[model samples]
Target: MKPRTSMVILFLLPASLFYLALFLVPAAWAFYYSAFDWSGFSDTMTFVGAGNFIRLLTEDPVFWRSFGNTLKIIFVGGFFTFSLAFLLAVLLNSGIKGKKVFRALIFMPNVIATIALTTLWAFAIYSPRSGILPNFFKLIGWEAGTKFLWMSPEHVFWSMLIAIVWINVGYFVVLILAGMDGIPLEFYEAAQLGRLSIHYGVWKTPAHLPVGLRHCHWRDDAPADCCSQYRCAPPDEARIPAILGENP
Candidate 1:
């Protein structure tokens, strides 16, 4: 073939080989294994057709229950994580006092190991007999005992949800904060000006203003006046101003 095609093939060959070896091989092996009656480490293997899948579908209530529980946890955990991250991002973006300290405090949990965090959560936070929750209950005039906590299956799920939320909130907060940081300041300034004009009744149809016009409000007073006559500014000239403060 041509020299360029040869060079492209050479560049991609190693990665393609690695993927075949690591992923394709294992997946093919699993498909083969699924049709067998082999004990995973046994020397003799027998083909069992679809026996395993048939049994799983017909008589596996426990497996199905566990799968359902996993889905529940994912939905609940994702909801809490996304909501808290959005709120945290908004708080960090606001020009509030001491926001840096709060952001650091929220993000500190992400640096910790998952196993270590789970261990601490199980022993220190949810240990029904002498855990922190029990102590707090006693201090608040409630009976501090095992009966009120982890002893119940219903309560255990809530306890797990709390731990999952605590561990993941920081990471999601950082992601959303980064997204917020990437939004141009001019968009916000334009939004503010749009609101002001609406309040003073100068612009009757604020919603009808082009997005470019809304963003032009961030320019210096001179440029802003010049640009105000037009509904929208050119994209090249409508850049955001430099951020004035340190990131929290």
Candidate 2:
């Protein structure tokens, strides 16, 4: 409607067209092929009319298992990853020694390739015969009782979940640390300066400090993690939603 907007669209149109041609055209072709029965190398495509979809829905236990596994990883593994990351972020943000070394130690795993990490975990830690866990248990005099088969199919899902958490937590830890760092240093100081009092128990932080303070009549794990909301910077708001890009 506006002249400047029209000119901006005109300027953006070429790149937009190029992107659509590069991405959407091939995606459309793939969608078309997905409905047919054809070897990828063959030219003839026998249209199956949702037959693949029907088979996948009604007969694919493997697919459903995979779907369930994905959900479990996303929720269960995600919970540990995010929770531990937040804890690590808080710990690292506090005045501590070897902060940089700790940060690097936590984050360097993320820089390594997933395949490389998998190889290390599989061979060095989870391998049934010569794995580190079994060997370590033996060294600790519990080999007979603790000969855990970590690489077995029954246990591999848990291994996968561990691997997923290990790979992911570092990145989010760094991210949350960055967000925590963005907050004014005064808040952290206030949290540390909280005086011991009977009102809120051990120590009562000022309104500006979020970490240790909780509303009266409400005390639990929920309030401790949700302290960013009980904070004063933006009135009452959770930093996690902001850290994860929900409130941002």
Best by lDDT: 2
TM-score of each: 0.67, 0.70
lDDT of 1 by residue, 1-248 (tens): 99999999999999999999999999999998999998899999899999988988889998888888788778988898889889988988887788778778888879888889878877787777667877777778786453477636778777877888888898888888788889877577656664654443353335743454454443334344544554654434323332222242
Residues 130-216, model 2: lDDT tens digits:
678888887898966457888788989998789889888889988998888798765455335433212334444556544433333
C-alpha lDDT score of every prediction, in listed order: 0.73, 0.74
User: What lDDT is obtained when candidate 1 is compared to the true structure?
Assistant: 0.73
Q: Alpha-carbon error at 244 in model 2, in Å?
A: 27
lDDT score, candidate 2: 0.74
lDDT of 1 at 197: 45
Which residue ranges in model 2 land beyond 4 Å of their true spot?
A: 1-23, 144-146, 189-201, 204-248
**lDDT accuracy of residue 68 in candidate 2:** 95
Clashing pairs in 2: 229-237
